[model samples]
Target chain A: MNDSMSTRDSLALAELVELQDVSAVAFSGQRLKPGRGSNLQLSVAAGFALTEQALSYKFDLDGSLVDVDENDPLVQLSLSLVVTYVPRNANAENWVGGDHERLKAFGDSFAWPAAYPFVREGVTAILSRLGADAYQLPMLRPSDLL
Target chain B: MRSLYERVTATLKGARAVAAARLRHEVLALLHQAQLASRMTQSDVARELGVRRSAANQVFRGDGNIRTNTLAEYLHAMGFEADLRLVRAGEPRQAALEQRAVRPAFEDWRIRRPQPTTSGVFVTNEGDDRPVLVRWAATGRTESFRVEAEVTTLPAANSFTPLGKRMFTT
Candidate 1:
């Protein structure tokens, strides 16, 4: 993947992680589903990671938080991060196992900061330009996951 | 000697007409109070609701039968609360029947009836004989009209002769 596209996709994935965080927070306020073991999953299809990130920022502006538990059966943390990228410019048939391997490697690396506070702040800043709040994203630790 | 079927049918028809007339009067009384309190013309209300003036007039005149949701919306627009009360079926029937009977007499005596401001009308037009009497307060004019064809002629027409004279001469 091109360096610019990779950076864009990574940022987009980070934003989705942010929104899943906010939903967790709002749901937490209601105390409907409590405990840190709760998990929120976001599926990013392909070309709309930017759109999803923008949406996440919008939710943050509306005072939402995302919370997850360490012992969650699926992904664990005070947050979650998932990023999958399909080549937008390249022909699908031309791609090989090497591309998949690269994506998996990128997913692991990109997922970390994407699940953290800095990306959330960045999203908040973007949304603030549109007259919304810039909320602090909660910190997460790998040890918190089971 | 009336048949059982005829008695049942007449009772049902009477109940329906009474219900319908009561609804009409309730709606009119509400609109009348709203008009007096707010000093708002029918056109003003119509404009606010994005409806035609005639539609608003119909609402005030208690002419159109409206849906509950639409009535609710109108009530909301007018800053009124819609409350539902649960009462015994027999209680409502008795109260409604009494009100239905006494209302015309009150109007005939030129007495001011106690009417609260409300948004919607409740009507049940089941019965065959429905008598509706409307009196214009300003002109002291009284008009008695009935829904039934058999009872179309006015009852005690002479009782209103004074009111008729007062309305026509001046």
Candidate 2:
């Protein structure tokens, strides 16, 4: 993994992170996780569940009202941001290929900045940016959800 | 309120329908032009392709699944190449809208006659500006109209039976 971020790429990533922070503050009124992946999960204080994807954000506010053993809120809103990066090599083999690892690292690094804003500020900033309800919760790691 | 899943499903269905209809229309138009240029009887072409006359008719009617290879063979037999390209969004919608606008007026002027069963001349008037004669066939039909106000020289018709002979002679 080359792991070298150009000045322009670094600045763009920083801006995306800032936007995520602003969104979290505006919506959930609480910051959950500052660094997460696209599969970041949240159990908001407002009884809503939040899940992030690549294309769009989804909100499952209804899950909050249900009484269950885990009692965690359902995902109410999901915010998806478009993140694009070229793989280090085009002809990398399947899962065991070095090129595949490089590509995954590249995507993870680019996605980090956007994930930061969400985690640091929480859902309030996100909902506020979207002119929606507040989301209060801690960020759920991708591994935990899986 | 509709769920997110409903919205995405509807979008996918709408896109698929539009694509299928456009493909059908394009294939029909190409076959129609090829048949007209070839000047071979539909039955003859059907025999050559080892298909029924109704199948040939369906080719013009834009019904039936046409394998790409079969369509290519048909086009090659007619001395034409089959080419397809993606249609941009703007033009198809504009064409559809124009067709819809003209359809009602055309229908109002159309004279409904008994469906013709064989190749023959038919004349009918439903308050038309001129007298029209239509040549009817099971596969397709052609129409010609004569206006009282017009005096123009008509081109002599050429006798072209089989397409292969016509091409080599020309």
Candidate 3:
């Protein structure tokens, strides 16, 4: 993640940008039969998603209680959010250089932070509703992400 | 966010691909279930249908524009039939009841709709939230490849469970 912001994060953030929108691209949470494991398996995948107006970054967060049966995710939730940003001047989508690292960096600093609250709120509400085990999505500082 | 899926569905070619993909998706599911229920293999379906193993495999894999009659024939060979039904939309509970009470929606898809084909198929391996990228050229035909840092050729559907396959002309 350190190298992610090396060339683009500053530039993307430096330019006046609008967190133009945040929308749920996908959301599904189910509470299946009780499972054996108590652990929470969490996976977070981030990437750049092009928008009509600008370039956007999307984050997918999947959390499921640890279970012996892979099919049985006692309590599971998957959320995908796209955070679109309108950067000053250029069409954000056109500005991307197709560098994977740069796009990832842009997602980390710009997309993740803006989308984190919504993600956390979503996860909290679902798990709470399901009456599943209590756990918090860690609030990671920039350095903590490294 | 505009996914490769959105990009593919935005044009006429993409519209054809979407229709084809949807049909193919349903066909593959039926093929899998029917074969499993009958304890038959693709080769068996081929033998029953008097086609090459590859041809039978093609239909099973959703590789080509398989015809409605062909789907019925394939299912008949395996001791099943395609059933299409019309249901009215209603409340969530009503919809759930209708889903259980009526015949499957897609089984009839293979029995009713005309199939579509394109120059290429966008094969999606399991775990991709959206189509990140596609590499092409398979067995002298236009097939899909995946690139998420490394470029990996798509595997056979049997080997890898493709959650979805969206086909389109270049």
Worst lDDT 10-window in candidate 3 chain B: B161-170
DockQ of each: 0.00, 0.00, 0.01
Q: Grade the docking of candidate 1.
A: incorrect
Best by lDDT: 3
Q: Candidate 2: where are CA atoms >4 Å away?
A: A1-146, B1-10, B95-170
Report lDDT (Cα) of residue A146, candidate 1: 10
Q: Which candidate is the best by TM-score?
A: 3
Please report the TM-score between candidate 3 and the true structure. 0.39
lDDT of 3 by residue, A56-123 (tens): 66666777865544645688788876665544443445544545555555565666777888877777
lDDT of 3 by residue, B1-170 (tens): 88675687688887676666655776789878999999998888888889999988888778767788988999999999986454332232254457755333234433332211112223455786453323222232123333223223322112211111111110
> Superposing every Cα of model 2 onto the true structure, what RMSD results?
34.0
lDDT of every model, 2 decimals: 0.37, 0.39, 0.59
True contacts kept of each: 0.00, 0.00, 0.00
DockQ (model 1, Cα) = 0.00
TM-score of 1: 0.26
